[model samples]
Target: MSLRCLIVDDSARFLEAARTLLERDGVPVVGVASSGAEALSRAAELVPDVVLVDLDLDGESGLDVAAELARCVSSVIILISTHSLEDFQELVAASPARGFVHKSALSARAIRGVLGENGTGSAP
Candidate 1:
C-alpha cells in the first residue's frame, strides 16, 4: 500500500510545493497543516502512515511538536528542515522521530529508507 503522509510546515509555499512534489513522486499525502495546532487537528483525522514535520515552525518548537505527536499517534515521524542536519543531529537522534531529512533531500526514497522499505516491501 502507498504510504499515507501528512505535512506540517509553517510556510504556505513549502506546504504547497512539498505536497505537489510528494504526490508526483507517489507519496499519498493525506493532509497539510500550517501550524502545530492545525497539524494536531488533522492528525486526529488522517492518522497518516508518516508525518513530515519541519524542524522550525516560526516561533513554535518542532521538537516539542514531534514529542507530542509520538505520544498521540502510531505513525512514523520524520523531521525535515532547511537547515543542516549537523545543527540538530543530537536532538533529532534523541527525539521520537524516526529520522531527519533535509528539505533539499526530501524524496519518496529517502522517506521509505527511513521506514526500511526498498520499494518492493517493508523491511523484515
Candidate 2:
C-alpha cells in the first residue's frame, strides 16, 4: 500500500514544493500544517502513516512537536531540516522521531530509507 504522509513546516513555499514533489514521487501527501497546534490537529484528524516535521518552526521547536506526535500518534515521525545532519545529530538521536531527512534531500526514497533503517518497513 502507498504510505499516507503529513508534512509540517512553517514555510508556505517549502510546504507547497514538498507536497508537489512527494506527490509526484508517488507519496500521497494527506495534509500540511504550519505550526505545532495545527500539526497536532491534522495528525489527529488524518492519522497518516508518516509525518515529516520541520526542525525549526516559526515559534515552536520541531523536536518538541515530534515528541508530542510520537507520543500521541501512531505515525512514523521523521524530522526534516535545512541544517546539516551533523549539526543536529545528537539532538535527532535523542528525539523520538524515527529518523532525520534534510529538506534539500527530501523524497519518498529518502523517507523509505529512514523507515527501513528504523525497522518500520518501507511501506504502510
Please name the candidate that would achieve the greatest lDDT relative to the true structure. 2
lDDT of 1: 0.90
Across residues 1-124, which tens digit of lDDT does each residue of candidate 1 receive? Answer: 3689999999999999899988998998999987888888899899999999999998888998888889988888999999999999999999999999999888888898888878756564
Candidate 1 weakest ten by summed lDDT: 115-124
lDDT (CA) per prediction: 0.90, 0.93
Give every collision pair in model 2: none
Q: Give the Cα-based TM-score of candidate 2 against the true structure.
A: 0.92
For model 1, state the Cα shift of residue 124 in Å.
Answer: 21
Tens-digit per-residue lDDT, 8-39, candidate 2: 99999999999999999889999999999999
Model 1: C-alpha RMSD to truth? 2.8
Indicate the residue-level lDDT of 98 in model 2: 87
